[model samples]
Target: MSKVFLSAKLPAATTKILTDHGLTVSVYAGEGLISHAELLKSVVDVDYLITPLSTQVDAAVIDAAPKLKLIANFGAGFNNIDAAYAKTKGIQVTNTPAVSTNSVAEVTVGLMLALSHRIVEGDAQMRTSGFPGWAPLYFLGSEIAGKTLGIVGFGNIGREVARKARALAVNVQYWQPHRLTDPEERSLGVQYVEFADLVQTSDFISINAPQKPDNHHQFSAAVFKEMKATAFLINVGRGPIVDEAALLTALQQGVIGGAALDVYEHEPQVTAGLEKLNNVILTPHIGNATVEARAAMGTIVANNVVLLEQGHNAKFIVNA
Candidate 1:
């Protein structure tokens, strides 16, 4: 029987699937971030390894696992994994893409609506019993109907967001490295625009791009300045894509109306200044955190391991 090491706790269903295949599984005992020494000790003799986004799979770590054949990531983003280094050692990598698309897309739309309508402010005021009565001038906010939405990356999640936005009567535009043909544009009902044009003219801008060297700090002070004063920004992608200091300055200086973020540069340790600002909406990286999404991701990870153990190609192999 082959041995597998799981870095984090997964859904019971996923564990059952793997155990039913007659494979030995060992789960790490600790929660939160696992130490490097702990990982090095645990993965020494395992044939397969399953990990989450928080775990870093670097060259040294991969080299330590002499018997390792496959690595299965629980999330769509594989930035934490050093793919190039892993390839050198003939280790296969796989991620569950499009498994949590709807869940994340729903969160993106929710953030946009919350920022545009000031939903959080209203909720806070009501909790404090400060709401006097309904008045014509009370809590005026931006309307979502008939506004232009610009998506930074047009992948599965981005496309789903556009579908929902169109249902609410919003025009959709997108900017990506690879251009979409006219037929593809017609099918998605989205226009391919230049990066500068998307930044300048969009009423609401949502980022779904992956984190790469070329895209790091893609939205800085200069990009913020190009946007209209009434425009709003929402990010459900990697945090470092937007410069934290620059975003803070933009919010304080009113470069744009407001901002919403589901991910941050230094996660779980937001800057003090960001906490003090009332114009921004923040969440604790819960875009694909729904119960359903987590279960689906776990199942995908388990299946990937099973396939490799059975001498078959994994369904979502990254290296292939």
Candidate 2:
């Protein structure tokens, strides 16, 4: 039997799918992401490894696992892996894409609505001081209808967000490395604009782009300065793409209206004073945390392992 090591716990059904095929699976038994030491120990003698976004499958891991043939990521993005290095070592990498599209898009729109309407703050006020009454001027929340939403990436999640945002009567414009054709734009009801124009004119700015060297910290102090004071910033992607310090300064100085983040620049650690602010909403990276999405991701990971074992092409290989 081939030895498979799962870096962290997966849905039991997902584990069952692998076990049913007679693969010997070694799983991390504790809570949360497995520690670096544990991951190093676990990879020493495995045939395949499954990882979550929080776990980094670097060169060290590859070197440790001389028998490893596959690294299956449980998320859409494989940025956590050292793909180039893995390819040189003859280890294939794969990720479960599109499975979290609707899950993330739902959270994106929810954050937009929650931030715009002061939902979290309102809930806090109600629980602590109690609402005096339904006063019109008490908690003046902005209406999302008839507003412009600028998406930074026009990928699966971005398109899904656009579709849902349109249902709420929001005009969607996007800026990506590539532009969509007239027909595609018409089909998705989105307009392609330059990054500058999207930032300057949007009523809300949503970051959906992946983190890259050139684009890392792309939403820094300089970019925040160009946004409307009333425009909210929404991030449902990688945290490092936005400079947390710049974002903190922007919110404190009113450079932008407000912000909501599902992912932080520092994973599991939010910047100081961000949580204290009434204008910002923070989530613990639950973009694709739905039960359905996770189960599907687990299945994909297991299937990738099975496909490789059978000498067939995996479904979503990142570094072919």
Question: Which model scores highest in lDDT?
Answer: 2
lDDT of each residue in 171-204, candidate 1, tens digit only: 9999999988899889989999999999999999
Candidate 2 local lDDT, residue 240: 92
Question: Residue 216's C-alpha lDDT in candidate 1?
Answer: 91
Worst 10 residues of 1 by lDDT: 267-276
Assess each prediction's global lDDT (C-alpha) against the native: 0.90, 0.93
Best by TM-score: 2
TM-score of each: 0.96, 0.98
> Model 2, 181-278: lDDT tens per residue?
89999999999999999999999989988878878899999999999999999999889999999999999999999999999888888999999899
In Å, residue 148's CA in model 1 sits off its true spot by 1.0
What count of clashes does model 1 give? 0
